[model samples]
Target: MNLKKIILSRTDAIGDVILTLPLTAYLKKVFPETEIIFLGKDYTKDIIENCPFVDSFISWDAIEKNAVSEFQKINADAILHIFPKSQIAKAASKAGIPIRVGTSHRAYHWNTCNRIISFSRKRSDMHEAQLNFQLLKGLDINYIPELEEFKDINLIEPKQELREDLKEILNNGKFNLILHPGSKGSAREWGVDRFAELIKLLPKSKIQIFITGTKKEGLLFRKDLVVPFPDVVDLTGLLSLKDLMLFIKNCDGIVAESTGPLHIGSVLGIHAIGIYPPIRPMHPGRWAPIGKKTKVFVKEKKCSDCRKSGRCKCMREIASIEVADYITAL
Candidate 1:
């Protein structure tokens, strides 16, 4: 029970990593002296580093290259497989880190992990953040946090300063809103046309809009969304992850599907609005942003038709005007 150092392993995308941060806050509450080391992928390094709860970050790539040796170097008292990887589970066991926590569902965890918790993410109705708390049962920590408790966690604090050019782009008078139209094909998109419509609805004098995405996503929607709206700033492919975090911190709000920036905006205490489809597991009920100023837009009904398709008609059906109205109200 007197654990000094623990590794919270969630080598996943930005949003997933962001969701896992609240668990660190709770862990710190229980064991204030415990050194929290985050195990994440190279791309999500910035997200993990920004977390005030995490003491250090160890790249999953390093562990994958030399699992046992790398894990042994840390000398962690416990390792939680937040995102179960067979390689990590095996290595943690080999390294003899004492407590190894993972879900019982994964067949490999049975052999490698000593502390296995019974829970199914797909079947459970808990929010993604809440679901992560189930892993704590492995450590004999039974307290489950309510959703409201997450608001004051201060999960992500942007340490990076914005560049001169990026800093200048922020409109002090207007509501500086960011429109992230792509999810890297991770979630059901609200489509470029709807985003364009939303942009058009918001008055230029009142809302300074910025479009963010990868180079490929920008290229895909450039002619249709960017060129047509000359007033909107095209920051796609320009800002790095750290830069984006800094920029979001300065901005007033952000609107996107279930993606990294949306979660980042929420954690920063900005007006983070998420558009979601009413599909099982993917619905807002499961993956909504946990923030003081977060809002979700989704059709209040069950949807199974677009469960497999990324281009969800149900998501698109949530009118652009409705989103615009909500933003203006905020």
Candidate 2:
């Protein structure tokens, strides 16, 4: 099928959107003439803006209001429904996009999409990013990249102003280690109490630790604090998404539970240490960060259905001292 323009729809959260970028870059490399348009939530626009492969980014919200009109304006050759939104599938089909692509298992795609590829994420051994590449099967693009090569799909350097600000944050001559203790409910957390204890365990002189999360998370931690929270720098409420990327860019490493920051750190080629449980989809095998200097810390054996029980022994079993030692060694 000859293609000139295509829409790559992934209206998902930050990490999911970030994972989709490598496929975007790879497609651009293979089909240099195909204009790649990304469909995502308005909040994730910052992440797409940084992706050099994406020719344009259209908010899914904007398109939902008037699908046919919007799709006509986009006028793409095809639509790759990576995230499987039923409304989007119907819209693209109604728009008469010549080659509508999606997975066969979605069921909705059977009616809404003309070009469907067989895929099942549950039984697959591939990482989430690599799994997104499977949609290329419909286009007869059959290669899925190795995990290490995902780093090459990184964004252009952080903005110049962000770089200048980072210099000051790192002026203390200590290794900057970003400690992200919140996961925004996207994945199982490594516990804030555990993070505080780990901070106290790390060497004071060698590493400058920074605690990061959203303002709501900061307020929750503050209210929950029994003793004063540790002596690390707290930057929970302030940074924009772009600012956070720059901050992670300059830092020596990041220790985060399975979350957006961990993925960002990985793509930037920084030391991205992901703290994961042995949980199924959340396990390191499925969600671990990919970078030159990335590592995942998880306990042995399956972390079976712990979120429902309210007590996860395996995740809590990982010691603060062990994590501190790992960070300091890096």
Candidate 3:
């Protein structure tokens, strides 16, 4: 296919958008002359624009306000819906894009999309990044890239400089680590008690720790986690998304659940240690950070008792001593 312009639509959360970045890298490799426009939410604009492979970014909000006009102005040859959105699919069809790619599972795609690829995200054993490549089948690209191939792909380039106050917090002599204890209800958390225990176990003299999250999360854990540890720096609610990315780039590593910042740390080639449950779909096997230095701590056994609840006893059971030892070794 001799395509000139392609819009990669993934209007989703941070981690989902991060995983979809590899698709742009693959697209660039196959179609060197083709322009890649990433259609994403406003919150993810920084991430998409910073990607070296992405040529431009279109705001999904704008598309929602005026789908046909917004898409018509793009004049794209194709649009791949990496994260399926019904309205976006309908808009792409209404705009008459030459090749509209989406999943066959979506009944709406039968009418809206010209090219539909058949696959089940929940049933597939592939990693999130690997599964993203399956959507490329719509473009006549049959390759499903291996997880190892992602190690070589340079996805994020943090352009913003770290703030002066944040820069001063970095210790050149020690490993500057970020401990994100909350997931904002996205993934099952590793529990504040466990994180507090992990902090106490770490060698404070050899490691500089910083706790990061939204202001709400900060207030929620401040009393139990931050107040107890006077040495730990509190950066909650202080960082914008761009600041967080730049900050993660400067840090040595991060420990969190399957969240955006963890993925950022991984893509930046830092030691990103993720804590996860053994539950299906949410397990590390499916959503693990894609980086050369990433590590995952999950229970060996599979149990779905907590599948319906937000809390996971299995994830909390991962010992603080084990995670501390790995960080210390790094």
Candidate 4:
């Protein structure tokens, strides 16, 4: 196929978009001359902006808002649909992109695309990264090693002011330990009482603790506060996603619930300890950190709150001393 311009679409949340970045890196590395375009949501743009692989980026919703006019403007040779939807398929069809490739589920139709491949819905069986990798098969790109997939994208350094601010907080040359207590939804949190107890236990430790998350996480952060804990700092709702990355990279280790920051810490090669409940569907090989230094602390329970209910039972079982011990050992 003499494809010069390519549109890769996957308009999803932050973690979903991060997993798909390897796909972008793979495409760009193999076809260096190819003009790579990413079609995603607004927030996705921020997540992928630093990716050296993408030639140009566009938001699918922005195009949907002005379908006809936008379609005429983006004249591409092929469209790679990561998130296959009727609206996206319809727009790609109307744009008259010569080739179209995407998943067959959701909104399947003759008008959808000529190269539609079926995507599995089974949660436990498939890794999100591997699912995105499946799209490569359609483009004649063979399977590559997991670690080699990401072409070394340059590291984005945090702003000087932010770095200085963080440095001041760390008076001594102490190792920073980041704690992300709350996940995006209510289903993932390990609870505030447990975190508060943990903080109280780590007073004299050499580890400097820092907490961060979105504005919604402020409620949980306040609840997790201890009366007197030396070198404990809270920056919840203060940093941007990029700033969060810098903060994590600067930290010696990370202890977080299964969320975006955990994934970020894994990618940064920081020692990350993920706290998750032991459930049937949860597979370490699939969801656990790809880095060797990363460890997953799963508390096995009969119910395991994660199997049927999304709430984590194992996290509650893990004691404050256990978590503190793990960090000290690392």
Candidate 5:
């Protein structure tokens, strides 16, 4: 298959978008001159805007009818549909791109693409990053040694005046710890009482808490949270995606559940304690961040509800002291 222009469609949630970056980077590493375009959600533009590997990024929302009109100006050689069931794929197919590659898994609403690579496994089989990369084998780019892990940063800098304003807000402030108690992965959260207890455990005199989330999670935080400290900075529903990333970069560390921010922190090399439920899988080596600074807290239990979304009895048994001890070690 002679692929000159390529499009990777991964217009899903944040973690799925982040996990697919390795494929884009690998495509660039193998075929540096090839024009690589990424199709993702509108909000994720910043996540990949600075990726040197990607030639251009097109918002999936822009495909009103099909990808032909939007990508026609760009002149792509082929399209690689990561989440193939997306309407964007139909648009790309309608656009008359010669070659299209995607996963062969028939579980989800699998669409008809020209070339489908079969990497079907159980849901618990492989990391999403690896599965996405396997789709590239049709282009003779199949080697998937672990990609070089690095902090993901965009080049978008605030104006000089805005920078000064941020500096003023941070002046004379104690070290801030991002306490992200919000997650979309299943409803088995540690609850607000646990978060309040965690705050009470921290020495509030030396540290501050920034409760962060989007508009949905902001509502969740308010509904369940009982703040034990006065220094809590509830910035939920306030910061944009890039703003949240910047805020996380400045913080000392993050203590969060299995959320997007946790993965963001992992990508940034920030020390994070991922409060994983006991029922979840245990191999951080394959799934979570690979660096030494990241620590995962998953309690082992006899009967785990590991159906990817069931209630996990193991996570409920985890204690705050163990988490605090892990933080102290970090």
Candidate 6:
């Protein structure tokens, strides 16, 4: 591989961005000296900073404003469109990025991308990370590595100062559990009532519970979950994304609906139990957390209610006691 500097563009949600990191990891294994540039939204900067393989981060907004100059500044040898956006594709084309890779199914890619791979992500049985690797077919990487290979990718450790502050709420012998009740409308929630019930089911003496989410989500959950537990800590609105990333590293486990924090917890090697609905694309098979201690709770068969109603109780059906039992045992 003659590639020196390559840009992997994925300007999407947090979970999708997490799944795309393995691509950079795999490339670094094959081409150790290559510079990896991640072109993504401004909000995902912290995630880019955490990756050792990534040499730099280019904001999508900057690319949109001045694609030629941005590409000129870095002199990227290749560009991979993991999450296809017409503007980025066109910009890469205009900048004359030598080895522009994109999916053949996307009509715009034919005109913009120099190299294209024929693959369908929706119908494939592969995990999202594996499917993302398929876009590398143009580079003669024909096979997708297993889920375990992706899990082996390195992640940043928790900051020392962040751990010291968390010591106040974390018990010495108890399991530190972070319970996130909302999904920020990213995915269908498992319901706040279910999360509250799960909290009650856990042994307070053996478990330290902490609730985390945006301020708005905290307000939504405040009515039912306001009453304090013996060891439950409410940290919904206080922590920043950077702090949350470090905080997850200090915890023993995390229980949340399919969300960004769940992915972060799993990547950080914490026991992450992701509650998900059995819907296509959103199912565990596609987007489950990739880690040694990851577990998913999704309905077994086709969800009858959600298929018709567009709202799922399938995830809610996963009993709180069952999740609580597993977390305590962890």
- Alpha carbon lDDT of residue 122, candidate 5? 44
Candidate 6: stretches off by over 4 Å: 158-160, 228-230
| Clash count, one per candidate | 0, 0, 0, 0, 3, 0
Superposed model 1: Cα runs more than 4 Å off = none
What are the TM-scores, per candidate, against the unseen true structure?
A: 0.98, 0.94, 0.99, 0.84, 0.84, 0.95
Residue 249 in model 6: shift from native, Å?
0.4
lDDT of 3 by residue, 1-330 (tens): 899999999998999999998888989989999999999999999888999999999998866879888899899999999899999999999999999999999999999999999999998899999998888888998998889899878899877788999899899999999999988899999999999999999998999999999999999998877898898999999999999999999999999999999998999899999999989899988999998899999998979989777789998789999999999998
Mark the regions of model 4 whose C-alpha exceeds 4 Å error after superposition: 121-124, 147-163, 201-204, 226-230, 280-284, 299-309
**For model 5, which pairs clash?**
5-77, 66-91, 278-315
Q: List the residue pairs that clash in candidate 6.
A: none
Instruction: Answer with 2 or 3, whichever has the higher lDDT.
Output: 3
Location of the lowest summed lDDT over 10 successive residues in candidate 3: 302-311
CA RMSD, predictions in order: 0.8, 2.0, 0.8, 3.2, 3.6, 1.7
- Candidate 5 Cα RMSD (Å): 3.6
Q: In model 2, which runs have C-alpha deviations exceeding 4 angstroms?
A: 163-167, 223-230
* lDDT-better candidate, 1 vs 4: 1
Better of 3 and 6 by lDDT: 3
Error of 1 at 46 (Å): 1.0
Candidate 6 local accuracy as lDDT? 0.85
Q: List per-prediction Cα lDDT, in the order shown.
A: 0.93, 0.83, 0.92, 0.69, 0.66, 0.85
Off-target runs (Cα >4 Å) in candidate 5 are 107-111, 121-124, 147-174, 185-188, 223-226, 278-287, 290-292, 301-310
Off by over 4 Å in 3: none
Better of 3 and 4 by TM-score: 3
